[model samples]
Target: MPGIYLGAILFSLVGMMLIDLKYSLALRVAPVRTTLTVLISTSFFLAWDLVGIATGVFVKGDSPLFVGVTLAPHLPLEEVFFLLFLSYLAVVMVAVFERRAAARRRHGGGRSATHRAPLEESA
Candidate 1:
């Protein structure tokens, strides 16, 4: 019960990673860039949340859904995973789109660009 919320999030994160692997996404496609992207994005959001909490604009709500763990006064453990999930989502979306575009290019959406006759022959 202590880790219920966090556990669910971790499990889902694993699933997301598996999806990425299956599609050669993020870590598979560009491990370094993908890692940096996720780390930076999560850090930015966490900092933003911290600022809000400091300004009294954000407050932790009582939720049975939460495992009720906190990393700070009002920061829940699940908040971290939620951020992680968001980062993964972005990475996955970008990877999926990129893969689709690549597939299209490799297949035959447009061969004109790659196939060009000699200049003199066309004239």
Candidate 2:
């Protein structure tokens, strides 16, 4: 159970990547942009975590699921992987929404049948 959490995270990351690849979203669409976005976001979150740790707001609790590794005093090695997954998830989600919106626009200004006005009855 020590590495279960890490395994789960990595599994989920792989699934997300498969989805992105299948749909040519995010990473498949723009590798450099997606990488940069994830890196920036991960870096920002890491900084936030550091600040929280400094302020005593963030603390690492003992867990059997952890890999027993720490990057810093309160930061775990798995934290980086989790942060990367989170950032990548965000990027993939945005790409999905953008693709859907673009498809909607191409089809007709993004108005679905539900949004269309009802047709008039014949005389």
Candidate 3:
């Protein structure tokens, strides 16, 4: 239904925004780098999707549940947006995990520093 498609779009946008905020605030990523990474990843996914559609690996069916113009069998412009949203979400999840791991390493290293005595004894 149109309602479902609309809801999907809204949810995707919100999710992407949250992910962006998390990366920006927690990872301290620059806006330019974030934007570039997302842009590049999205482009790659889109190209892959397009190829899949062309090769019949992915086919669209007649469904009123989708938004945008359908150029081929079940293929709609809106699918690109959906893919990009999902891809960005995946990247954000990876970034969050990496950030957590790095934090843990730093914290553990700091604690270990106190346990190890100084190499050079006081004269």
lDDT of 1 by residue, 54-95 (tens): 999989987777887788878998998999899978989988
Assess the local accuracy of residue 110 in candidate 3 as a C-alpha lDDT between 0 and 100: 42
How are the candidates ranked when ordered by TM-score, highest leading? 2, 1, 3
Backbone clash pairs in model 1 (N, Cα, C under 3 Å; residues 3+ apart or in different chains), count:
0
After best superposition, candidate 1 residue 12: deviation in angstroms?
1.0
lDDT of each prediction vs. the true structure?
Answer: 0.86, 0.92, 0.69
Candidate 3: the clashing residue pairs are 60-74
List candidate 1 segments past 4 Å from native.
107-123
Q: Write the per-residue lDDT of candidate 2 for residues 1-123, one digit (tens) a residue.
A: 899899999999999999999999988779999999999999999999999999999999999999999999999988999999999999999998998899888899866656665562232
Candidate 3 residue-wise lDDT at 29: 67
* Greater-lDDT candidate between 2 and 3: 2
Q: How many residue pairs clash in each candidate?
A: 0, 0, 1
List candidate 2 stretches off by more than 4 Å.
110-123
